[model samples]
Structures are given as structure tokens and as C-alpha cells.
Target: MAQFDVEAFVDRQKIGRPQLAVLLVCLLVCFIDGFDIFMVGKIAPAIAEGFGEPVEAMTLLFLCQQIGLAVGAFVVAPLADRFGRRSMLIFACATFGAVTLASVYAQTLFQLSIMRGIAGVFMSAGLPMALAMISEATPRHRRSTFIAIALAGYSTGSAASGAVAAWLIDIYGWQSGFWIGGIVPILCIPLLLFFVPESLKYRTERNPKDPGIARTIQRMDRSVVLAGDEVFVLGEADGTARKAKLLDVFLEGRTWMTSILWAACFLSMANIALLAAWLPSFFQEMAGIPIQRFAIIALIAYGGGVVGTLTIGYLMDRIRATTLIPFYYIGISVALFAMGQVSFEAPIFIGILLFWSFAQTGGQGGLNTLITQVYPPRMRSTALGWSGGAGRIGGVISPIFGGVAIAQNFSLQLTLTCIAVVPLIVAVLVFMLGRNSYARQAVIASVVTQRGTA
Candidate 1:
């Protein structure tokens, strides 16, 4: 057997316990983030009834939160590089948690919308920071699996929101869902403080000669290392370290690639946001099922997402992120179209939604992992953040647009089937961009290999 270059392979290889633990924390936070976002959709009917308003009222609230996600990911994540990942996470989580709790007392739809938006500002930081921390901590080769697993928590949380909302509404009220959403994150704060260590890569970059570098490195697991070096020595850290700039994403053949990735994100998420926002309503209105029944279907879809994410993550490492994504989108488009045709039979329509959920939701982690690996560590968080922000734009539009189609009394089949085109277009874009992404990565690898050899 040909021997593998252990160091280059190490970062991309399978990870261990500590890395997984931190990933779980990130996943848990993301889970909460997912729940917060999905909760509104699950409880939309209740919220509308409670506020004595139209479903459109909830759309405004949903849009506000998504807008916050866009702004936070685009604007706030870059700042994390300067301020420090640990500090940013601490502040972000606490703020989001508090705002989420306060939302429980919101007296009107307008007030709740504002509170949700404010909460979004904090929750938005969770994924980018978590992914950044995991990217820095895990070996690059194995990073995708760790990321997929963490994001799985997100899907699971979204799924759980349906059940939880149903139970809470029956017992306490719709407000209880928000209360739990807010309070659960508070628990993460202390876990973040206690168990989740600061990114060693971030610390080393901040001050190579700060005298604390050695201590930080020594305290970390010995398995954690850079791609090529005797070891991750502080002063000798990769000369690639520089002030992370957003502009860096536009340089050296990356300008077009960034745009393409952004487009892919936009389309992929549009459907995701739409489905989350409208599924329960669709089931109630079109399928003539009770809202609680629809919630079960949503849970099934979410479960499929978890499985899809893990499966896709494993495949991405072998097949490469670029190659895996286009097919995933195409699969989602097909599955969604099929979903539009099926009746509410237990195995058919539900199965179609599961397939749609599996492909689309799983592709999310694949896309983010691709972005994280493509960018240099200096700009990794910023790239991830902005990409997420771009996706949020799609998310912002998807729900409102879907709501309009439904409100205008469009047939469910026509509305959902037409929506599938968005992902298909995204699939084409992803194919082009994936090819470009691979070529760029190949060039980067060849250059680095030559330098090491020299």
C-alpha cells in the first residue's frame, strides 16, 4: 500500500473525543438556534390566533429574525477574529439567550417580532463561531464529519420544536416554547465557559510571542496540529497569518467562486426556510390534517435531515465537497417535486418530504464545510459568516414568498412544485462553482506541496 502523507491527511482525517465534545457543544447551540428559528413556524397558527392577526403577521416576525441572521453573520463574524472567538461566543450566547427569554413576555406581534430579531443577532453568532472553533481544533481532513455531526444537532432541534411546541401549547401555551428556547441557551453558556476551550489556532495567531502560546499548545491534545511543520510552534506559525479581511475572499481567483457559492447558498436555503415555515400550515390547509399531525411529519423530515447530513459528510471527505453538492441539490429538487404530487399517505408523501429534507438539509453542512476549507484560517469565520448571511437572504424571501403563494389561494401542488425550480437552478450553479472550487483547491495544494518539498 502507498503510504499517506500523515500530516496533510491529519487535519482532514477522522477526529477524536475532545474535538467531538466541542463539536457537540457547537451542535447543541446550533440546535437551539434551529429550534428558535423553526419554533415560530411550528407555532405560527397559535401565534396568529393569539395576536388576532393574519399569518402574514408571523411572516414579518420571521423575516426580522432572518435579517438579523444575515447582518450578524456578515458583520459580526469578521469582528470575532479581532475580538477573540471565546469572548464573542460568550457574549453572543448570553445576549441571544436573554432576548429569547424576554420574548416570552412579548404582548403583541410587533413586540415579539422585534424580540425575535434581537434574539437573532445573538443566535447568528453560534454557527460561524462554532464551525470556526471546530475548524481550528479538528484536523482539517476530518473537519467535515465533525461539522456534519454538529449541524445534525441543528436538524434534530428543528424537528424537536414541532413536538415541543405542540406539548407546550397544550399544557402552558405558545409562549412556553419561547421560554424554553431562551432558557436552554443559558445552560450552554456555562458549558461553553467550562468545557469549550478557546480555539488554539486563534490564540496562537493573536500573539505568537505572547508567552501564553506554549502553554495553550501544551494544554491542547497532542494530536492537534497544522498541515506541515515539525509542530505548531507559535513563532513559526504559518506565515499565512495576517489580519483577516473580507476583501481576501475576492482576491486570487476567488471572486467569482464566492459569488457562485453565495448563489448556491441562497437557493438551497430558500426551500429549507419555506418548508420549515409552511409545512405545518400546508398539512393543515391542503391535506386537511390537524396541525399536530403536520408537526409529526415535520419531525420526520427533520430526522431525515440528521441522517442525510451524516451520510453526506462522510461522502464529502471521499468524493470532495465540490462534487457532492450539486447532486445533493438536484436530489432535493426531485424529491420536492415528488412531494408535491403525493397524497398524505404515511409512506409516500411523508417519504418524499423525508427525502427532500435529507438532501437539502444535509447539503447545508457540506456547503459550509466546503467554504471553511476553501478559505484560509484567517478569513474562515468571515467566509462562513457571510455565506450564512447570504443564505439568510434566501431564507428571508422564501417564507414570505411561499406565504404569498399560499395566501393567494394557489394550489399546494403548484406552489411547492414551482418552488422546486429554485433548487434546480441552484444545482446548475453549484455544478459550475463546484468545478471551479476543485480546480482552485488543486492549485493551492500543488503550491503548498512544492514549498514543502523545497
Candidate 2:
């Protein structure tokens, strides 16, 4: 009887149409995800104006949405491990879209916040699932790059939200942003259903008898022939034979490492979410930059994020991520300090904003990629989801921080400086993680070498 190692075959194959199709589908999902999630923040001032409230009043909206996101990441995303990544992803897209569209009809900020909170539950599935799908589909050598390329779509979608707001908010009101965000994802459902395949590794582990595995392998490589009676394997030796449990993330000497990751994610995401939620309002209120002008600046800055995402992904493939990601966070601190100093200077501030986004958004991308590498396929989604869910605690806190700063009339310099501190802390945590990861890799390499010599 013929035996096949599914993961080995995937790693050996070159990037082809099948791989590209996976990337494309993931890219679109990420793009729409970024667009919807960031749209409210991008148009916050407009939404506040429409509701006849101070912009700071939107804090509850941000909080509710984030809490829902935390819940979804913790609860909903892990189900992908059992149910299927593709199916869960499609359901998330459809439900999130419908809820987001309904948000446009909300008559008050409170109502909108409730709707956004509901939408957030479904929206939270996008990134982790996209990362898991892309990671499983691509070759091991190029995994980070493929994940990065898909993430660029997320950056693009985020930037696009600012652009769309700049164009549509004044003409069609804030609802227009929600309208586009909602409609696009619902429309993409057909494409996801038809083009994206479930992770072959997932199918193999969950039900080795699944006939779809044979069909998928054939699609991945048209030239390969498979017998109907072949025995399939994942080539994983570490307890992947059984169903994955959440406890698996902490097993295998991962207890300390998981704690470190959760801490780093908490700090890093707090900073990112705070900035995403309030940067537009910050520049408008503190820097006295007009909303329209800042919108254009945001587009330019988030473009830097796209570049950062791709660059980090490429470098991670070549360099140790432990060594590379910390520098990005350090750069964030420097950029934030420089941004505080140059608040009034458009040319200098824009440059600083670019670097900030490059590091901030890109660094977040790096963290996401690292999570994918840390766990085995059986529990990868659970690890990603739980770590992200932990981070959402910080995300939930960020809006309140921003709101407090705005209410207390904090100086722009103080606010930016305070924000700078979090990234520096994150840098330290990432460095520690790097050391731990390096030590583990070294031990593994030594064992492999000794076994070979013996």
C-alpha cells in the first residue's frame, strides 16, 4: 500500500496556480476584514457629528466592539479546528457583512455601538483563520512571505477605508462607509465558496477517510497520481494523532512561552488598537490638521504599513523573526517620539507617521506570523485565537485610554510619549521570547545532529 506524507508533499511543491488561488482568496478576505473593522474609526468624527455627540463619546462603541472581538476570537475561531477553516471563514464573512450593513440604519451612537459589537463577533474570525489557511497551504520555506503577502491586503483595506471615508463621508455621510464595507464582503461569499479549499492537513487529521483529501492533492499537483487505498499522514510526531485540545497549547514546554506571547500581544495590540481608534481624531483635535487633510495623510501612512508588511515577511523568511521583530517595535517608539515633537510640521509629521505605521502595523503582522510558527497544525488555530483573544483585553482598554486622554485635555506630547512606552515594553517582551525560541531551536538542532552521528 502506498503511503503519503501530506505536509512533506506541500513543502516540496513549488508555488503554482493552486497556491496562488489560496493566497488570492485569503487576500480578499483579509482586505474586506480590514476595511470593515477600521471603517468606523476612520470616520469617527463624522459618526460623532451625525449622532450629535463629542467624538470621545465613541469610546463605548470601540469598547463593545473590542469585547465582542475578544469573545469571538476566544470562542468562535477555535471551532475552525474542528469544523473547517474555509466554512467558518465564509460564515464569518456573511454574518459580519449583514450586521455591518444593518449598522448603517442605527439612529444613535448607542444603537450603532450595539450593532458594531455584534458585528465584531463575526469579524474577529478573519485574521487568525486567514493566517492558518495560508500557513497550511504554502510551502514551509515561503510560509511567512505568503502570510505577509495576504496581510498586505489587510493594510491596503485599512488604508482604503481612510480613502473611502475622505471621498464618501462628506458626500454620502458616514453611512456610505458602512454601506461599502458591508456590501463587498457579502458579495465575495460566492468566490470564497468556489475558489478556496479547506486545509488538506485539517481534513487528513480530522478524518483520514475523507475522500476530498485525494481530490485536493490532485488539484495541488496535477501530475501526481494517488491510489485510492493510500494511507495519508501529516508527518508530525508530536501527539497530533489525537483531536486537538486547548490544553495542548500549554503542553510541550510551552507554558512560559505562551505566557510571554500573551503579554507581548497585550501590550502590542493595546498600542495598535489605540492608534487605530484615535489617530485621526488625535491629529484633528491636537495637531489642528483638518479631517480631510489627515485622511489623505492616513492613506499615505497606511501605505507604509503595506510596505512594512511585505518587507517584514520577506525578511522573516531570511532572518530569525525573534531578532527582526523587536527592532520594529523599537522603531515604533522612536517614531512616536518624533511624531510628538513634529505635530505641527506637516512634512516631518507625515514622514514620521509613515515610519510609525510601517513599524506598528508591520510589527503586528510579525507577531501574527510568529504565532503561526509556534504551535502545531492541530492546535494552531486555538493558539492564535487565544493569544489574540488575550490581546483583545488590551484592545478593549485602549479606547478607554484614548477617551480619558481626550477628556482630561492631555497634551499631545504627553499622550504620544505615554503611548511610546507600551511599544518599548513590547520590545523587551519580544526579545525575551526570541531568546527562549533561540534556546529551544538550538537544543532541537543539537539533538538532530547527535542522532545523525549516532
Candidate 3:
């Protein structure tokens, strides 16, 4: 009887068309996730005026979005552990698709807020599930880069949202942006069903010895599919599902690592949520750029994120994440500080803000990769879910925090200075993490194992 070790096969083999196929489905949904998540913010200024509400009304929408995200992460994401990532992802995608469409006709701001809150719940689950599946599929050497590439879809989605807003919001009204965001995901549902396979590791883990799966793997990679009834699995225990213990994430030697990761996720995500939610308004109000032009500038900023992730993903493969992550955060501080002191000359101002976006969003994406590295397969989903929940908490607070600052009429320097402190804190925490022997050891174990399932 011939046997194939799935874990060894994936870790040893370079990525191929089979793997790329999975990533494509993940990326497409994440693109939809980004649009659904960020679209409300994109239309905020217009919606505020349309409803005869103060601009700060956007704050409620942002809060509801995060609140939903927190519930999704803390409450919903871990369900993937028992239910499987593919199922959770498809369900979330469908749920958000329907909710986003329903949200367009929400005549009252309160109704829109409620709808967005629910969308956030589903939106929150999309990325972590995609990351887990991608991580499981990728080879160890290419894990960071591949994960970053897939995640780049998200930033691209945000950039696309800016483009849509610029084009549609100006003419058909903000509702059109909502309409576009909603329709695309529903359209993708068919594609997801037909094209995207369940996580390979997951299927093998569930029923490693199944003859059908062996044939599927045979089709996926003929060389790895050994003949006969002998089929084998790697990086996972036998077929019985591993139920997550919530406390297990913090227990074991992972206590400090969990805390630090949560802290880092919180601060970095707060920075991202704050900036992404408010930047267009910032440029429109402060720099007096027209809404359409400012939206394009915002697009440039997020587009820089695509570049940042691709670049950083390459560097992370060579450089230590400990050293590299801290530097990225430091760069974030420097860029924010620079933005404050610089004159609003379009060229210089736009350049600084773009770099700022590049640094901030890239650094945040790194945090996502870092989570995959920090946790092993068994607890990975749980760790990501909770830390993501923490990030959502930060997301929940950021807009309100920024709103209060703006309400008090804080200078851009003062407002930004306050926001800049988060990454600076994250930098210190990252460096301290770098110094920790336990963290270094766990990270090494996860990378070397590369089973990437839980």
C-alpha cells in the first residue's frame, strides 16, 4: 500500500496551480469583505448630508461596524474550529451579501446602523478564515509572501471602494456605492461554490484515509498521491475534530505572547480603523480638496498598502519579523509626524499621507501574518479570532475617539499626534516580544511545522 503525508507534501512542495486556485477564491471574498466593511465609511459624508444629520453621525455607523466585527471575531470566528473554515466563510459571505443589499434602502440612519452592525459580524469572519486556509495550503518558505499577496486583495478592495465612491457618489448618490458592494458578493457566491475547494488540510484531517480524498489529492498532485489504500495525514492528529478550549489560547506557555499579540492587534487596528474611516473627510475638510479628488487621494493611500504588503512580505521572508515589525511601526510614527509638520502643498502633502498609509496598513497586515506565525495549528483560529476581536474593540473605539477630537476642534497635529502614539507603543511591544525566548521558540515551532490547521 502506498501512503502520502499531506503535511510533508505541502511544506516541501512549492506552491502550484492548485494552491493558487484556493487563494483566488479567498481573495475574491476578501475583496467583497473589504468593500462591505469600508463602504459605509466611504459614503459617510454624503449620507450625513442626505439624512440631515451632523457629520459626526458617521461615528455611530463606525461604532456599529466594529461592534459587529467584535461579535464576529469573538463570537463567530471560533465556530470555524468546529464547523470548518470553508463553511463559516461561505455562510458569512452570503449573510453579508444579503445584509449589504438590504442596507441600501435603510431610510433611517438608525436602521442603517443596525444593518451595518450585522454585516460587520459576518465581515469579521471572512479574513481570518481565509488566512487560516491559505496558511494551511502554503509552503513554509512562501507562507508570509503568499499570505500577504492574498490579503492584498483586501486593500485593493478598499481602493476600489474609493474609486466607486468617487464615481458613483458624485452622480447616482451614495446608495449606488452600497448597491455595488452588495451585488458583487452575491455574484461571487456561485464562483465560490464552483471554484473554491475546502481547506486541503481540513479535509484530510477530517477523513485522511478516505479513498475519495486520496483521489482528489491524486488529481491535485499526482506525484504525492501514492497508490493503494494507504493514505496518510500530517500536521494534524487523527480524524476526530479538535474542539477549541477558549482558555487554551491564554493558558500553556502562550500567556504573554497572547497578551502582547492582543495589544499589538488592538493598537495597530485602531490606527488603521481611525485612518481608513476618516482620511477622506480629513483631506476634504482640512486641505479643502474636493470630495472627488480627496477620494482619489484616499485611493492612492490605500493603493500604497498593496505595495507595502508586497514589499514587506518579501522582506519578512528574509528579515526577522521582530526587527522588521518594529521598524515598520516606527516608520508609521515618523510618517504621521511628518504629515503634521509639512505644508499642505498637494505634491508633498499627498506624498506624506500616502507613505503614512503605506506604512500603517502594511504594518497592520504584518500583524495578521505574525498571528499565523505566533500560534500553532491547534489554537491558531482561536488566537486569531480573539485578537481580531481585540482589534475590533480598537476599531469600535477609534472613530468615536477621532470624532471627539475633531469635535473639540483639535489641530491635525494634535489629533494625529495622539493617534501616532499607538504604533509607537506597538513598536516597543514588538521589540520586547523580540526579546522573549518563549515567543521566539513558539514562532520557530509554528514555522518549522507549517501544518497551519486547527
Q: What TM-score, over all chains together, does every model reach?
A: 0.85, 0.88, 0.87
Q: Write the per-residue lDDT of candidate 2 for residues 238-334, one digit (tens) a residue.
A: 2134577868778877888889889999999889888876877777777787867876676778678888999988777766677788999999999
Residue ranges of candidate 3 with Cα displaced over 4 Å? 1-4, 45-60, 203-213, 225-241, 277-297, 346-348, 400-411, 445-454
lDDT for each residue of candidate 1 in 341-401, tens digit (9 for 90 to 100): 8777757877888888788878777887778767755667787888888888888777787
Clashing pairs in 1: 11-139, 11-140, 11-141, 12-140, 12-141, 12-142, 13-141, 13-142
The better candidate by TM-score, 1 or 3, is 3
Residue 143 miss distance in model 2 (angstroms): 1.5
Give the top-scoring candidate (lDDT): 2
| Model 3, span 225-316: residue lDDT tens | 36567655655444444445767777767788888889999888888878766755665565565767765565567667788887777666
Task: Give the range where candidate 3 is weakest over 10 consecutive residues by summed lDDT.
Answer: 445-454
Q: Estimate the TM-score for candidate 2.
A: 0.88
> What TM value does model 3 have?
0.87
Ranking by lDDT: 2, 3, 1
Sum up the clashes in candidate 1. 8
Q: Which stretches of candidate 1 lie over 4 Å from their true place?
A: 1-17, 45-60, 221-241, 279-295, 407-413, 437-439, 442-454
Which scores greater on lDDT, model 1 or model 3?
Answer: 3
